[model samples]
Target: MRIFRKITTPSNYHHHQLRSYVSTCRAVVLPSFGGADKLQLRSDVPVPPLKPNHVLVRTRAVSVNPLDTRMRSGYGRSIFEPLLPLILGRDVSGEVAAVGESVRSVIVGQEVFGALHPTAVRGTYTDYAILSDDEVTPKPTSLSHVEASAIPFAALTAWRALKSTARISEGQRILIVGGGGAVGFAAIQIAVAAGCNVATTCGSQSVDRILAVGAEQAVDYVAEDVELAIKGKFDAVLDTIGVPETERMGINFLKRGGHYMTLQGEAASLTDRFGLAIGLPAATTFLLKRQIQYRYSHGIEYSWTFMRADIEGLIEIRKLCEAGKMKIPVDKTFPITQVKEAHEAKDNKLIPGKVVLELD
Candidate 1:
C-alpha cells in the first residue's frame, strides 16, 4: 500500500549528481624534480573534481617538450609550484572519460587532444586528466593519437607567432630561424599555407626536408650565413633559437616597421632609442636611435596562445594535413616507462621531430 508521489524535478538536483561522478578516477604523480628518473608513476593520485565547465579525459598519448626537461630539473619552479609529487607532461591526446555538469561540447568517449596546463601536465602523462572544457579540443579523426599528440604545443605556438603575432599573409617574405626543429617545421608549413614566401635555416642534411615542407628555400645554418643568404628585407622573422646576437642580425633583415618575434627573447630593435626596459638589449638599441617609424615592437602578443586547444583550430590544421599542405614527422616514440630517456633525447637534440610517449 505504498503510494508514489508525483515525481517533481528540482532544478539543482543534477548538480549534486554530477559531483558524485568525478569522485572516482586515478592519475600518476611525480614526487620531485630532478631527472626523468625521479618520476614515480603512481596510480593513486586523485582525479581533480570537475568544475562546472570542465571535462575529465582518459589520456591516450602525450608528446614531450624541452620545457618539460627544464621544469623537471626545477628551473621554472619559482614561477610555478609543482603541487608535489605532481604529474608531468604537457601535450595530451585522449578520449572523454567524463564531463562536468555544465559542459555541453563533448560526450563520453569522444577523442580529443590539447595542451594540458603546466600543473596538469603530470596527470596527462598518466591514465587520466581533467581539463577545463576550453582547454581540450576534438582530436582530428585523420590523425592517429600519437600524431595528434605531437600537434598541440608546437603547432599552436607556431600559429600564434606567425599568424597572430606577425600577421603574415600571401606574398610576404618571412624568415624562420631554427627551421629544422619541430616548431620551425610547423612555422614553414603555416606560412606556406598562407601563400607567403618562406625561408628557413637548419643543418645541411635537413635542407631537403625543409624544402619538401614548402619552404621556398632552406639555408644550412652551419654551412651558410643565414643573414646573408636571403640578401633583402623580410616582412617578418620567427626566431626560435635563443642565439644572443641573432636578434641584432635579424633587425637588419626587417623592412621598416616589420615585425620580429621569437620564442626565446624580446623583440629585436634597430635604433638606439631610450625609455625601454633593462632586460631587452634590442629594445635598448631602438631607444638609443629613436627610430620612430622603422622600429616595431612585438612579443607580448601571444597571451591567448597559452589557452589554445580550440577544436576549430585543430580541425583547420587537419585540413592542411589531409590536403598534403603540412607534414607530421614523428622522430621517435617511447613507452611510458622511458619518459626520462625521452627528455634526454629532446634536450640533447637527438630526435629529429616530436618525441611521444605512448601509454595506450
Candidate 2:
C-alpha cells in the first residue's frame, strides 16, 4: 500500500565513497616533542593524500632508531621544531595500497621497504604512509615484513658510510668503531661482504657476535683502549660513534692516503648543543681546517656523512639479503600500541640489535 518514488543517486556519491575508504587511519602522533610519553595513538588521523610522485602504503611493520628517541626529546629542535606533532619513524616494510598516477615501478599489493628521510615530515609510525617511489625497493622474499622493517634506516646508513663514503674495496683493511649497535652491525656485514678485512670495537659481551658476523678482529672497547688493542693502520676507518675523541682515534687508525668517515655530522659537537647558526659555520671551518692539516700531515682523506635514503643503495641491500650475504639482527618486537615501551627500551639500552614494532 506504500507509494514508490523514483530512486536516484547523486553524481558525486561514488567519489565520496572512494574518499571514505582512505579518509583516516590510526597513527602514533607526537602532539609536542618531549618524551616517549608524548606519543599518542589516534584512530582518526588522516591518511596522507597521494601526490603525483608518491605511493600510499599499508604499513605492516616499522623499526625504532636512536634518531626517533632523540627526536622525541627535542634533539635537532631547530630543524624539526616546525614539524611538531609529527610522526617519528624511518624504516618501513609494507604492502602498497595505492599509487600515484606517475608511479610506474611499484604496483598495488607489492611488498616494499625503505627508509623515509627524517626531514620529509612524513613518517612510518602509522597505519598508512606515503613513500616516494624512488626511495623504496621490492622487499626480498627471504625476509619477513618485521625483519625487512628492521633494515632500511640502519642498513642504508651502514651501506652509505662504508660503500659510498669510505669506498671500501676488496681485501682492504677497515676499522669500524662501535660495532655492536644496529648500524655498526650492518657495517660489519657489508664490509665483510665487500671482501674487506674488518676490525671492530664492541663491549666484551658483543665481541663474539661481532666476530661471528665476519669481523676479522673484535676489540672489547670497555676493557681495552681501541687505539692500543688493535695493531696496524687500516685502509679506511668508519666511525659510528661520533665522539670527538673517537673521531681523533679513528684518524690515527687510518693509513696514509686512506679515508676516514663518520656517520655523525662533523659539526655534531657544536650543533647538538647550539643552533645551526653557530654550529654550521664552525663545523664547516673545523672540518675544512682538519682536512687540510690531515692531508699535509697524514695524507688522509676525512669526510663526515649524514645518511640519506638512496634507491640504488637499497636495492643493493635487498640483493645482499636475498643472497644471504647480509642479515638483520632483531633484538625484540612490540606491537604498535607498545611504542612508548619500545622507545624506553631503546633509550635504556635494554636490547641489542634493532627494536621493531609490528603493526599486525
Q: What is the lDDT, from 0 to 100, of the residue 149 in candidate 2? A: 93
lDDT of 1 at 270: 19
User: lDDT tens string, model 1, 1-360?
Assistant: 121122222355343332223333344455677766776655456655556677777788888876567667765453334356666777788898777667777776789887765444445677677777877778777788888888777777787777766788899999888887777888899999999999887888679988987898898878887777877878887878846576666666777657766676323221112212443565445434534323434222211122245555555666776677766578899987777788778777788677888886
Model 2 CA lDDT for position 160: 83
Of candidate 2, the 10-residue stretch with the lowest lDDT total is 1-10
**Could you tell me the C-alpha RMSD of candidate 2 in Å?**
5.8
Query: How high is the CA lDDT of each candidate model?
Result: 0.68, 0.83
Best candidate according to lDDT: 2
lDDT of 2 by residue, 175-253 (tens): 9898888888889999999999999998887888888878999999888877778999899888889788988899888
